[model samples]
Target: MEAHLLPCKISSDGMHVDVQAGFVREETDSISFSGHSVQKANFRGRPIFGTKLPIPPPYEAVLAHPTDSLGDKEPARLFVKSKVSSITLWNLSDEPKASDKIPSAMLWLKLAPLIHSDVTYSN
Candidate 1:
């Protein structure tokens, strides 16, 4: 799989990085974020289910909405320790751009209510 580090902007909470998975887009496969530690998370918007790393990545996955109409929707969220110095996403077909600004509050609002509160959510 071709991997690339995307240019991401940092928010108060975490960084925003866009990754383009060039080859691996199967409905059942999940991507792993590797840094000082490795974090495995599904690209779907489902709540995170695992332990939190003290030395976290520079960005947190808030949502992982699919960009295209492939009908393969997978929203994900991640947590970074501080500002994102860099970002490397695996299984990417092409290089992706980065942004420091977070997505619109409305988007979060739209998604927050949809997700079940019982589901564990952390950043």
Candidate 2:
């Protein structure tokens, strides 16, 4: 399937970026916006609903590196052990204030032809 991007924007904090990631199904379209956060909260009960925890603002000067000084370039090479540790930090760390529902810009473009061109040429 061929997909087209509509339009998108970045948050002032840079923690969140919005975009039309991809499309699927019918003439109808799909879109998505993602936000970055340090913390998430959980309501402890049956059918629990929760809120994300609060995190410090993004600091451009100093921030977490995808890798560390020790040179573990492929730290994620240890996925099984790291997943839990990562989730724990995500749950407890402070996240961006969940506000500022900034709207993304949209671009209307004609969809590309989807049928197989070679099929029409075959004898």
Index of the highest-lDDT prediction = 1
Q: Model 2 off-target regions past 4 Å?
A: 1-45, 59-123
Q: Judged by lDDT against the true structure, how good is candidate 2? A: 0.23
Count clashes in each candidate, considering only residues at least 3 apart in sequence or on different chains. Answer: 17, 6
lDDT of 1 by residue, 17-123 (tens): 44456222332232222112322333343222111122233324332333345344744434433343333342223211112122233235446655856777799
Q: lDDT per residue, candidate 2, 1-123, as tens digits? A: 111211223236646443323211121121212232222233232121112222222311112324334555645322122211111111112222223221111111111223323445556
Q: Estimate the lDDT of model 1.
A: 0.31
lDDT of each model, Cα atoms only?
0.31, 0.23
In candidate 1, residue 19 scores what lDDT?
46
Give stretches of model 1 more than 4 Å off.
1-35, 45-84, 92-123
Task: Locate the minimum summed-lDDT window of 10 residues in model 2.
Answer: 102-111
lDDT, residue 30, model 1: 29
TM-score of each: 0.16, 0.14
Clashes of 2: 6
Model 2 clash pairs? 39-53, 40-53, 54-94, 54-95, 55-94, 55-95
